[model samples]
Target: MASNDNDNSLIAGALFLVAGGIVGAGVALLFAPQSGTKTRKDICRFARKARRSAEDAVEVVEDFKDNLSDIVEEVGERATEILETGKDMAYGAKKKLLKALEESGEQLEKQRAKLSKLVG
Candidate 1:
């Protein structure tokens, strides 16, 4: 659980870094001297790139979330299966023990009857 939290934190940090870098680059471009038309075009290009990068990051995050959910569900199913199997095995063992006990009791009763007949 701690590891999962760490992984999530790392992903968040990486996304933040990418966003910060894009913002910093845009700010730097704004300060640089250039013709008005060229500057506007550059800013527009940078904005578009940043938007695309953000969208990609969001998609990656969504994919990670989906995969993690699937893994959790799979683990839950496996655990349930293991529990049920254990229960079944225990029940089977109990039944076998009971059958053995009944047979032993019957045998002892037969032996006692035979001994009484001989004594008589």
Candidate 2:
């Protein structure tokens, strides 16, 4: 949980820095004394750069999501295997206990028969 909070804080800090840089660059470009055509070209270039940056961030996010999904699936499969193994062990133990009880009962019956014959 602490790691998650730290990750969130790091992401927020990075986003804040990127946003500040973008805002500063826009303000600088707007105030620069340049011809109308050059200003328009500069604005278009900046917009293209920003779009590329956004696309890259999206791709990174998508990849992270895919990796996280795979990790979750693997954990779920491991948990299921562990659960099945536990059930099998329990069943084996129960069978062994029942067999022991049956053997003990047979021994007891034999001793009872011998004792009765001796008394008669």
Candidate 3:
């Protein structure tokens, strides 16, 4: 969800920048005192540059999205590995505890039997 929000914000920001560039270009063309031919050429150049900038921005956003996805995947894999290791360690400890308990019970039984035999 947070990633979704970040993606939305990035797209919105890009759109705003493009919109602002277009408005500024329009205002500049209106106020400039150049001949029609020169103005037309300038407009064409501005359009091309704007297109390139927009394309570059898109590529940057795509790269960032891909990087974020890869990092998330790696983190998930690491967490799973850690969880499995923890489970294996716990199982080993439990087995050791049960074995010790069994041995203690057997010792108690032997001591009780010896004491009864001596008393009788």
Candidate 4:
């Protein structure tokens, strides 16, 4: 979710930058004492640069998304492995506890029988 938020923020920031650049360019053109031909050329050049920048931003996002996916998958796999290892350890511990309890009960039974004969 945090990654998603960051992605959204990056996209929003890129869009804002592009929008601001275009607006600034337009204002500059309007205030400058340039002919129509020069202004048109300038606008065209700025548009091309903007398009490239937008494309670069998209590529950046794509790479980030791909890297995030790879990281998520790796973490998921590690979590699964850790869970399985914990289960195996728990099972081993349980078996040991049960064996110890059985041995203890048998010893108690033997001691009780021995005491009963002596008491009788």
The global C-alpha lDDT for each of the candidates, from Candidate 1 onward, is 0.87, 0.81, 0.91, 0.90
Can you write out model 1's per-residue Cα lDDT over 1-120, one digit (the tens) per residue? 885796688678868978897889878888889887887899889888888887788788778878888998999999999999999999999999999999999999999999999998
Q: How do the residues 10-118 of candidate 2 rate in per-residue lDDT, one tens digit apiece?
A: 5566566667767788888889999878987897898788767766765675577568768979999999999999999999999999999999999999999999999
lDDT of 4 by residue, 18-54 (tens): 8798889888987889899999898889889988988
Of 1 and 3, the candidate ahead on TM-score is 3
Sort by TM-score, best first: what order? Answer: 3, 4, 1, 2
TM-score of each: 0.70, 0.63, 0.80, 0.77
RMSD of each: 3.9, 5.2, 2.4, 3.0
- Model 3: colliding residue pairs: none
Off by over 4 Å in 2: 1-24, 32-42, 111-120
Candidate 2 pairs with clashing backbones: none
In angstroms, how far off is 111's CA in candidate 1? Answer: 5.3
Local error of candidate 1 at residue 79 (angstroms): 1.2
**How many angstroms is residue 101 displaced in model 1 relative to the true structure, after the best TM-score fit?**
2.2
**Residue pair clashes in candidate 4:** none
Q: What's the lDDT for candidate 2? A: 0.81
Candidate 3 lDDT, tens digit per residue, 1-120?
998899989977997898799779967986799888888888888888888888888889889999989999999999999999999999999999999999999999999999999998
lDDT over C-alpha atoms for residue 105 of model 1:
99
Residue ranges of candidate 4 with Cα displaced over 4 Å: 1-13
Q: How many backbone clashes does every candidate have?
A: 0, 0, 0, 0
